[model samples]
Every structure is written in structure tokens, then in C-alpha cells.
Target: MTAVTKRFGQFTAVDNLSLDVPEGQIIGFLGPNGAGKSTSLRMGLGIMEPDSGSVELFGRAPNVQSLRRVGFLPEERGLYKKMTARDTISHFARLKGLSASDARARADELLEATELGEFSRSRISKLSKGMAQKVQILSTLAHRPDFLILDEPFSGLDPVNQQALENLIRAEHDRGATILFSTHVMEHAERLCDRIVMMARGRKVLDGTLKEAFASLGQGARISVEHGFDLAAALSPKGFEAIRTADVGHGETWRIELPPGREAQDALRAALEAGAPITGFAPEEARLRDVFVSLVGEADAAALEASLAEDGVA
Candidate 1:
């Protein structure tokens, strides 16, 4: 989509956002809640129309022909409580143009891959939350679409299930499918994305490869020390702001903020001079959460998270 804009009354939900999903690449659409990630995705998938600009899928405007080759998992989780897991998946596959036999076979294969084969005959209402999530994801992939768009695929999942989902995404990517997913959790994107597109307040704030994004943030390091360490005293005199600090058993760890052109080791040397008994020290790569704070401001980032928790919009 290029220069796509969506509005609700006087509020601009998505402000002239432009994005491209390259074939066979896993792109992480990252942002806090209400940052327009969902809105941008809806426009691209033809679920909602943009008041202006254009959206294209596979070289032309998004339409039925293009949609057949696409698989989508929306943010909200929903499945028919009366339907069996296998039947639910097969139903969606049939909608995507699969024959009865093919859909059933594909659904079985997917259920097995996700380790939910035992629940294949279980009604949706009888499954646990994680089990239901896996089933929903299987339903999305039953047709084997060439392109996949997942909005917050990890939300509400336990660690084990989240890891399982990540493996599934990796397998799909290895099959040469193009994947685009959105998420508030930084760890997922940090591990899976080949490229990242960051949004804030309905605008694209950053877009690049992981390495490029880190390099652009200058330099920094996470510092940990043994007991009797004073992180604030060590860096404050040198004009370095410890962006974050945490007490760790009789000691403290600091996330030092580095000015442009400064190396992470510089902070180490400063710690040494300050007589801190260093337990661990290394260069810190900028995390996506840090990038969010830098781009969107601390207050807004915190507010977004709070809203997500209270409203359950993950």
C-alpha cells in the first residue's frame, strides 16, 4: 500500500502510511496498541477500504483473486464453540477453495504439526486457551496460502505455546511463503523478523533491517555488578544517564545510555574507574522496546501498554 490513509470522523487512525511486504520475507509490523498497525494491515488485506491512496497485492489492486492466495489471522480470537477443531479448520479451508478431502487432509496435517492432534475431535469450547489458539492458527493455514498476515499471533499464549507458534512461523517461511506479522512484544520481532516496520501515532517512525536499526541508535551496554556497586554514582559524573536500573540480589544492573560516537566499552572503563565490582559486562544491542521509547516517548509507550492490559486488545 502507498500513501494509504484511513479516518474515523475527525480522528486519523492511519495517516498516509505506506508499506511493502517482500516475497518470502518475514516482516514484523511493530508498534504499541492504537498505533495504527491494525489499521494499516486491514487496508492492505482489503478488509477495510482507505479513503484515499491505493493498496496492491501481487501487482494489482487487492481483490478476490489476490485474497485466495493470502491467509489472515486477525487479532481477535473467535471460533464456533459447537464445531470440532478439525471441522473448523476444514471449513475455513473450504472457503479458501479447497475440496472436502483436501481440506480434511490439510487440517489433519496442521493439527499434528501443532501438537494438537489429540484435540482434533474436541469441540472448540472444550479446548484450553492455548489449544484453542493453536487450532485458530491451524485454521488460517489449512489452505496453504502463499502469503500470511498474522496480527499479534503471540498474544495470550503461554511460553511453550508461543515457542510452538514461532516454530510454525519458521516452518512456513522455509516453505517459501511470505509472512507479515504485527506484535507489541519486542522479543518475537527481535528473534523472527528479517526486517521491521515501526509505527507510532498512526505514522511510520522506523523501517530497516535489525542491524541497521541498532547501528542507527549509536552505542550502549547493559552493565551488571556485584554487591556494593553504585550505578548512578558511576555514570552520573560522566554525564551518562542510566536509562534503566534494576536491583539484583545485593547488586544492581544498569542500562547505560550512550551518546553518539561513544563505544560501549567506554561505559565499562567508567565503571572500573568508579570502583564497581563488575560481575558481567558486554555491549548491548538496542532492543525494540528501547526503540519504541526513543521514537514514541516514554509516557505514550507506558500509556499504550496500560490501555492494552485494561482493554485486553492484545
Candidate 2:
């Protein structure tokens, strides 16, 4: 996408967003609700047109012809309630130009692979939310499109199913498919993404490889102690910001920002000199959530974290 923008009435749903999805890489499109993730994806797939700028799929603008090589799963869940799982998947495969027998065979294979074999004959209404989601995903992959665009594929799944989806995504990547998945859950992106593009308030906030994004947060260290100490007198005087202090089990933990000249050992040495009962000490690797909070602010990050917690999508 190059300077693609979208609007609904007076509200700009997507700001001037330009994104490049490298071939064969698993890219994470990340942001909170109303951050324009879905809108940007829709524009990329040509399901919705941008008010300005251009979107290229494969090489040309996305259309029926170009989209034949793409697979998409929208965030919204919808299936024919009266249709059996296998038939629902086969139907979509046929629509994508597969023969009837080929579609049915592919559906059967995918159903078994995703652990939905026993429910192949079950109607959509009879399956659990996770099972139904599996069916929808199978339908999307039945034709084995070269590119995949998944919007919140991990939503509503328990930990086990979410792991299963992660494995499936890896399998697809191994098969040479270019995948872009959108999510508010930071952990998923941290584990599965080769690179990430983050958005906030309808505009692109950050985009880089996982290592590059981590490096952008600078350096830091954490120390977990069994007793209290005067952090202000020790580190604050040395130009370190005490990022957080938390109670853990029978002890407490402190995360301190390290200045450019300092390191983790330097922080540990300072804590030891202060006579704190240190239990654990280590360098603080940058987390996706930390990067997100820094770029988007704490309020939006907290709101998104709360939304994920409510959905049990940790």
C-alpha cells in the first residue's frame, strides 16, 4: 500500500498509511480496536477501495483476477448454520475454482489436520466456537492460496487452540505462503512475526523487524529482591528511571531503565551495594507490549490489554 487512506463520513478510518509486505514473511499487523487494522486489510484485499493512493496485490491492483491467488479470513465469523462443516469448506473451495471431488478431498484432509475430523458431519450450530472457527479457516485454505490475510485469527480460541493455529500458520509459511495476520495480542506477534507494522489512531506508528523494534526501545534491566531498598537514592541519582516495582510471591521486583553507558551488571552491582536482599537480576529484553505502550501511550495500551483479558486471549 502507498499512501492509502479510507474514510467513513467525516471520520477517517485509515490515515495516509503506506505499508510494504515483503514476500514469504509472516508480518504482524498490530493495533487496538479502532486503530484501522481491519480497514487497512480490507483496502489491501480490494474488498474496500481507498479514498486516495494505491494498493497492489501480487503486482497489480487487487481484483477478482488478482485475488484468485489470495486467501482471506475476516475478523467477523459467519458460516451457514444449516450446512455441515465439511460441506461448508468444500463449497468455498469449489467457488475458488476447484472441482467438486477435489474440493471435498481437500476439505476432508484439512478437517482431520485441524482436529475437526469427528465434527465433519456436524452442523455449524452444533459445534463449539473454536470448532466453528476451525471450519472457517479450513474453508479459507482449501484452495491453498499463495497469500493469506487473517484478521484476528486467534480471537475466541483457548490456549490449546491458539497454539494449534500458530503451528498451522508456521506450516503455511513453510509451504511458501506470504502471511499477514492482525491482532491486539502482543504475545502472538512476538512469537510468530518476522516483522511487524503497528498502528494507532488510524496511522502507522511503528514498522520494523522484531530485533529492530526491540532495539528501538533502548536498553534496560530488572532486579527482583527479597527486601526493600531506596531505589531513588541508588539508581535515580545515577540518572536511571525506576520503571516499575511489583510484588511477586514473597518478594518484590524492580525494572530500571539503563542509561546508554550502563548495563545489567551495573544495575545489579548498584543494588548489591545498596544492601538490598536481591533474589534475581537480569537484563530486560524489550517486549512487544513495552514497545507498543511506548509508541501508543499507556492509556491505549491499557485499554487494549483489558479488552484482550476480557476475551481470555492472553
Candidate 3:
């Protein structure tokens, strides 16, 4: 999509967003709920028309021939409740242009690989929510399309299933399939994506590799000291910038921003030399959530945190 925009009545859901999914790369579309991620994705697939700008799929307009090479799993999931799991997968594969025999074979292969072989003959309504979700995912890839687009694919799954899906994505990539998956969960993106695109309130905020994202925020360390101790005041004269972050039961934690030439060891040395009663310390690892916070500020960061908690991640 190039400078695509979408509006819903008086509201603009996606504003001048441009994105690229390079072949053979795993791209993560990241943002909290209501961040325009779903809208942007719908526009990309030509499911919804953009109010402005343009979209191209497979180097051409999103036509039938080009769409045949793609597989998509929408955020809202539904399966034919009366259909057997195996039949469901085979049906979708057939829709994607596979022969009946090949589709059935692909369904069996996917069922066994996902440990759902015993449930192959079971109807969708007879399966658990998670099991039905797995069936839908398998249906998305049963035809072995060249490109895959999954939106918020991990929301209903437990930790084990989420990890399994990540492995599945990796395996598909190794098979020469390009993937674009959207998620509010930062950890998933951090683990799987070659590059990330973040959105906030309908606008694209950041687009880059993990290294570039972290480098933008520089480096830092977290130090915990006795509750009454003033680590920030003590480190101030030493030219270190420290801010109190949280309160542990026996101590308080302060985040120290390291200067360009400074290191976490230097911060530790400075605290010790200042006669500070330290209880705990560690180099602060940069997280995708932190990058989002830095770009969109505290209010939106709170929303991101809420979204994570809703997904049982926080």
C-alpha cells in the first residue's frame, strides 16, 4: 500500500499509511487496539477500498490471479460448525484452487502436524475454542500460498499454542512463503519479525528493524535501592539522569539513562561510589513496548499496556 487512507464517517481509521512486505521476509504489523492496524490490512487486501492513495498486490492491482497466491486469516474467526475439521480444511484449500484429492491430503498432513489428527472427523462445534482456531489457521495455509497475511492470530491461544504458531510461521517462511502477521503482543513481533511497523491513532509511527528501534532510544539500566534513599539526587552531580520508576516492597527502582559513551557498569560504579545502599540492579533491555511508549507518549502507552493485559500478556 502507498499512502493509503480510509475513513469511517467522520473518523479516519487509516491516515496516509504506506507499507511494504518484502518477499521471503516476516513483517509484523504492531499496535494496540483501535490503532488502525485492521483497517490498514483490509485496505491492503482490497477487502475495503481506501479513501485516498493506492494499493498493489503482487506488483499489480489486487485481481483474482494475484489473490490466488495469497492466504489470509481475518481477526474475526468463523468456521462451518457442522463441517468436520478435515472437511473444513479441504474446503478452503479447494477454494484456493487445489484439486479435491490434493486438498484432502493437505488437510490430513496439517491435522497430524498440529496434533489434531484424532479430531479430524469431529465437527467444528464439537471441538474446543482453541482447537477450532487451529483448524481455521490450518485452513488458511492448506493451499500453500506464496504469501500469508494473519491478523491478530495469537489472541485466543494459550502460551503453548502461541509458541507452536510461531514455529509454524517459521517453518512456512523456510518453505519460501512471505508472511505478514499483526499483533498487539510485542513479544511475538520481537521473536518472529525481520522488521516491524507500528501505528498509533491511525498514523504510522515507526518502521524499522529491531536494532534500529532500540538504537533510537539509546541504552539504560535499572537500579533498586532502599526505599528512603535518593539515587537520582546522588547520581545527578555525576552527570547521570535517573528517574524513579517503581516501588518494590523493600526498595524503590530507578531507571538511569546512560550517556552515549557510558555503560551500565559505569552507572553501578557511580552508585556504589556515592554511598548508595543498592538492593538490585540490571541493564535495562529495550522492549518494543518501550519503543511504542517513546514514540506516542504516556497516554497511548497506557492503552498499549491495557491491551497487553487484556490479551493476558501483562
Better of 1 and 3 by lDDT: 3
Clashes of each: 0, 0, 0
Q: Which stretches of candidate 3 lie over 4 Å from their true place?
A: 222-256, 259-281
Q: Which of the predicted structures, 1 or 2, would earn the higher TM-score when compared with the native?
A: 2
In candidate 2, clashing pairs total 0
**What TM-score does each of the candidates earn?**
0.81, 0.84, 0.84
Question: Residue by residue across 58-88, what tens digits does model 2's lDDT show?
Answer: 8898888778888899999899999999999
| Residue pair clashes in candidate 1 | none
lDDT (10s digit) by residue, model 3, range 252-310: 99999988667788999999999999999999788898889889978788888888888
Q: All candidates' lDDT scores? A: 0.86, 0.87, 0.93
TM-score of 1: 0.81
Give the worst 10-residue stretch by lDDT in candidate 3.
210-219
